[model samples]
Target: MPHRLHLEQFGPVHALPVLHYRLEFAHLVREAVRRVKPDCIAIELPSTIEAPFLRAVERLPEISVIHYEGRQRRDGAESVYLLVEPADPLVEGARLALERRIPLRLVDVDTDSYPRHVEALPDSYAIHRIGLTPYYEEYRRAAASVAPGREDRRRERGMAWRLQELAKEHGSILFVCGMYHLERIKDDFGRPQAAPLERVRRQGVRLFNLHPDSCREILDEFPFISAVHELRRGPLPPEPDDRGETLRKRFSAFELIVGGRKDLPAEELLRHAVERGARHAGRGEEFPDRQRIIFRLFQEAARHYRQETGDPVHLWQKRAFFRFARNYALASGALLPDLFQLLMAARGCVDDNFAYALWRLATFYHWQRAEADIPTISISPEEIWGGSRRIRFRPRERRRKGLSHLGFLKRKKEKRPGEWLEGFTDPSICSYPPEDVLIEEYGRFLKKKGAMQLSEELSRTEPFTSSLLDGIDLRETLRNVADGRVYVRESQRAKGGVGSVVVIFDEDRENGNYPYRTTWLGEHEQESDMAFYATPPEDNIVGPGICRCEYGGFLLSYPPRRMMDVWRDPDYVFARSKPEVLLLAALDYSPEKHVVHVAARPPRSIFRQIAARMGKKIVHIPLGSLSSVKLKSIRVLHILHGHDKRQVAKDYIW
Candidate 1:
């Protein structure tokens, strides 16, 4: 594929020992140069490719030479990295030009002085993305609600423009760049703007490239799917007709699934459902949908609602749906060969919502598949891979009683009969404990001890809520944001696992909402941040000022009754280390705690007494072994594995 000018080959380059293959490539290049014996020998690649190009190009320096390269990221971090990598391609090409004593021309985009923007200083040509942020957000979404494939077409014309720009400045002997990019380079936006080869010929400038057979090894090796892209894709296609009443029927099916009653129209219902979703988030609460709610969304957007179940009501769902869908399609291409093929067949058959859903499912299949690590064929040869699916959805079941329990409660509220709103109609209207109302009415309630406010002696807490503090100190500020009562300073940062609930539903595992993801609390959000992360109220054993942290599922906190105070009032141990008993007592039920293990080397009687105060016991054994400790009602068996670790395995008992 070399240009028709006298061809030359340069050989025996690189640090590798003069092996047969190494010498062969050098010999090939040397011969290509010898035939061309014209003024200058121009090689390809940037200056940093290797020293061989420098040596060869210099050998025939009667001709001028040049090197070429591309650009990468533009931020400060990437700048330092570029210094080491030298991302240019004209090294060997320029070295040959210099060695042949020929003239040289170097060409490429430069972002040395300014930050790289999508459309700024594009070396590949004038073509580029108009905006940056939207492009960045494209990959964040799991679905391809937007056109996810236009990036490849954009890269092509940009390169052509850059080359032409370079050609205008230099003489008839300008070499564009690497063969791969040059091959795909289009003179215009692929809309039949004259071909690159035609233009290069008009200028009387020759072009060169590599053959397909020569580069087959590399083409066969790498996978071409876009992973973690920073691209701005074009807009999405218009939605097609859903085939007679098929779309209507499918929408109805989803409506029936989420809402027990199927009478309501889909669009209006979706708005109101979103309103409910908003209300939950406004209070910083996770929206736990009733089964009725679930069935409604499923009926409307069956595939979509399934994934939206666990994500926050924020923009994450909409964004993730597209990204996940695209990735799934790419990874599942081999498994679901008909994916894009089927997509292309029907052409405009899918809507943004359902299309995003399908695409999201296909994308996430990588981790979801049992054998993600195993590569398989994505598109099959036999698959015609076109035409749209008329996936009519039908609800598996429906709830018979929608708020039947609230019927009498609405009657008791004494509203005009026709205007009555039942309990299920709205949950926020339901009554709170007397203390909440009292606090709202009388401020923080205090026992009027000797006509003095003793409210400071007690406090209340809500899950993930902090107590009200005025002119706060360290104790109240950190709260559940971190662990313990370690003194903190101004501008201190504390972050912990934020979203924790045992709510059961769909989309929990897939979206990373469950198991867990770390949400943050910086030194900002002030008192409210602490209040929301650690809402402390009165009457909890999490005693005085602030106490134990109710983080995630368990409490890593001290006994509410202070060690000093509880020591004076030993009966208080029931509220401190024994919250299990304390909670049962709150519910008027009694549970037992067993001192299951007696240490093999029993502690001193005085130590035993102190440990016993915290619900432990000590016992003696002759040998170092601890098989002697037996128990009843103990679920966690902690056997001593050695020092500092435990062999915690389930101990089955008869």
Candidate 2:
């Protein structure tokens, strides 16, 4: 059996040693304080920096770090940092003490003489399985292997001495210190040895809020863990019911950001995630590490991906993604990958959109408003409402006086001034890769809709007491077991192939509105030949010469031929408007007898007559019949005319 540490056993001075990296430890500390109600609280920070540190703690949700620069033993400079997030045990302890009107003492050795060495600690989550004392024992073995030096011993003795003095005044005093120093402090509990103290001049000391981007580096837990800790106001409990509530609350915040129905509860999703995480971790005597919650989040992301793309994440893909994430975690020097690492892995293994969903779900909790009075940093205009502020610890570099005029002039100049044409490039020569991916995705959507539209008239009836036979409807037969009757109905296999499609987004003859027309040869033979007439790219530039334009009309010829040049074809000159030209070209190039036309209405009589002369037919499908949002997305296509633009196209493409 594993041994658990008991705080009450230690009498007036109950030493609760903690490993800082695990958020669970912080919660444990908070629980101890609540149970013991110590008269005075002693934290493991130096007395010299209590004011600024406490001030930063008082400002809770606005995460801040203590930055101090002190003289080195050899005479140079050494920097020390301590991040104070709401989940931090020391910060929480201090806050609790302050809230309860208990005296909070900073009792560790001064920062200048504090041991600067770092040792890799065991995973804090292990405490859930092996119990606290056993985990601490393991940690002690790991730290002793590294061996403490004179400075380490001095710091321990000094903290011990401080605790001894505090116990004399307060009936019950609690001391929260590093796990490695705990055993040593107990050994020197009653000794009357002179404690070492180094009183160096206080160097540069400033308090700066922690930047969101740097949270992964300085914080002990995943941002999601930190977020949940903030919401629950403690570490996650081992009980299934409590865990479910916490998980649901976290995902509920995520759902709101992703535009889920405001009234719909996220409990079902959270329940599914927890069950799956437990399964994945394998059942044993110990509970799985809390990191398993990440798997649940990815599952949620996968569901979202299916909803958006109509595809499910394959089993192999999920395995590969976790493997890749683990490799990244190892590279990041962490026992498990956090959201940042997971996002990076997702981008490479999946796509940006999938990774983007994961990021949104993980970060949603950070933006949620605290229901009670909690410490939070002031929001900035750029941070968005309910969003954490972006800050940096590093000082901003001062610009030289000589270059100040240029900055002043740059600020004075209007951005994207119509008068300034120097930076503007030809739209036909530049490309936006993302726009290309969007167009491709929209094309796939169109193909699916066209197939469905071709079979729109056909209806399926099963469990045949009613209609003619098509096939044995096994699904209906299984569903109606009470009747035990077989049903069948009329069915037609989808046949009308959409060899070519012409889309006239602007049904009206507004030819003058679309000033630019461009033709693009497909990069590969499998792609379609395309010609489009839309707004001039130069006037609506997104990047350099890359411009976004609405599609007045377009022609798509599949199994593209090198001779397919619809824009310059004199055969289409007879057509009056861009839509007419595109319709004519689509009818002419379609290999199939019928062509799909997506427009406000059927083509003009002349175009129909031309199609009839060529022994071809047109299938008219209203533009509104298809998803408007999807069509609108594809209506805007980017054109790249030069090699310079095409060379870098892959970067912008998904």
Candidate 3:
């Protein structure tokens, strides 16, 4: 429920002060109109531009701008523009008056040379937690310290004179004006006032439709939030309380008879789910929550990000983004973050692809169009806000264009269905050469890292008497500062070198995600013998003979062509999962006394005991210690039917 403020009243007139072009103020205006039910509605715009402004407001949900020429000065004449948007309180009040058939009054005095006034105010989102009464009282206290200029005083007196005239005919009146001029208008209403010298009528005033692309740069509130407000303004059905109620409401007897026992279509199910989510998010409340709207925006952007780049946004990234955004808002003295802060946080926490996705979603307004019923005009950020901050978003693909350019290309698809399946007729299959080189390089790096960890475990430190064995250990020397003695360290090498490396990307214990398994020996001396389990190739065919797959776990052993198919090996029958089987094969086929294992967790203790019985050791390396970017690059593998297909595979891979 909205908290009603004690507005200033004189006779039958009530004055409500508001800030211009704010969504929270618009909601307050809506609530006030419903509660007051006044016969006449008064706004702060002048009578000269009333006709064109009302016509622009009639095109609700579509934005417009009023253009005119100001008075001539010693230098030249200036162009003036007034934006008419759904998020502005003045626009909403005018729209309500027209919709409810109430008498509308435009009561401000117009002057061609009115100077622009700018003031710093707190973020309006605070009204959600703090009531509007307290918010208005605080604004009143702060605004009382500033004095009014000549034109401001004159306009306030003129509006007071109009309200006095309106009070005689109408039984009740609601006057909506700016916070800066409200106090002066209320004081002048009690005393007799005269009409000030101002422009009674203007010539050559025109209204134009705002271009859809320009909405992002000029609007005070973001396009997505404004659209949310518009959606809540219409009639809405009663929201279900739980899942059972929602199912009962959606699955009716008519639907069952018409669909004949089949499930709902995917698009219909998705729409219903979205509608339920919106209602559960409190869109039916008296005032919509800005934080909830921001949360939904991020979720929608993440979905688009996943569809565009084959990558999932992690939960940790989302937490970090909100933390960063909160601190950014605090630094700017705001209770909540704006669109610019959200974009910056997204780019800092994730990558450019996610930030680009967020930008596209934030600027989308469904009702906006390039072709409208009026003359459309394109404007820039400099024209409205006087300045803007720039950010560059470059995706993974390289192009010749600069930072200001944006272009999108359609992904290539098969000309006909089942055309790619025909390329799989060949009996033989081989791995792509480039992917093999990358995996082998990563394996060597893991082996080197494991050796260093083993060496550190064997080294010892002691006090130096005459000669140092290896070198002085600075860390130990610092610890013995009280004794005033130097510490020396001795290093010993491990007994054997690492010969096999096993990398586990995912331990699929349920045995459903990755089902494909294969074993292949190297064709040349440079490659290692490989065995792996991965996603099915038939699900993602990219080209005539090429298919892409992600590795679940893999084994790489040097000296190719010596190992048999490990997936069917009877010796490793005790293994529980595909990752365990790969670990056992690594211990069995390794030529040296040491093997490297990399995964999210260390292997079972039984594997260590089995290696000890065979006079070998398992060196565990945590998978998170490696670079995620490098790991992601090596996890993707492409298979080809024949060597001739390698020449055209580059065109199909991203």
Tens-place lDDT digits, model 1, residues 427-465: 111111221233222211111110121123233233323
Superposition error at 449 for model 3 (Å): 5.0
Off by over 4 Å in 3: 4-10, 71-76, 235-280, 398-417, 446-513, 531-533, 552-559, 562-632
| Count: clashes, candidate 3 | 0
RMSD of each: 27.2, 17.6, 6.9
- TM-score: model 3 vs. ground truth: 0.81
Please report the candidate that would top lDDT against the real structure: 3
| Model 1 misplacement above 4 A | 1-327, 333-386, 390-590, 594-654
Tens-digit lDDT track of model 2 for 31-70: 6786777899998888778888888878775577677775
Residue 410 displacement (Å), model 3 = 7.4
Candidate 3 global lDDT: 0.80
TM-score of each: 0.18, 0.49, 0.81
Best TM-score among the predictions, by candidate number: 3
Error of 1 at 377 (Å): 39
* Decreasing TM-score order of the candidates: 3, 2, 1
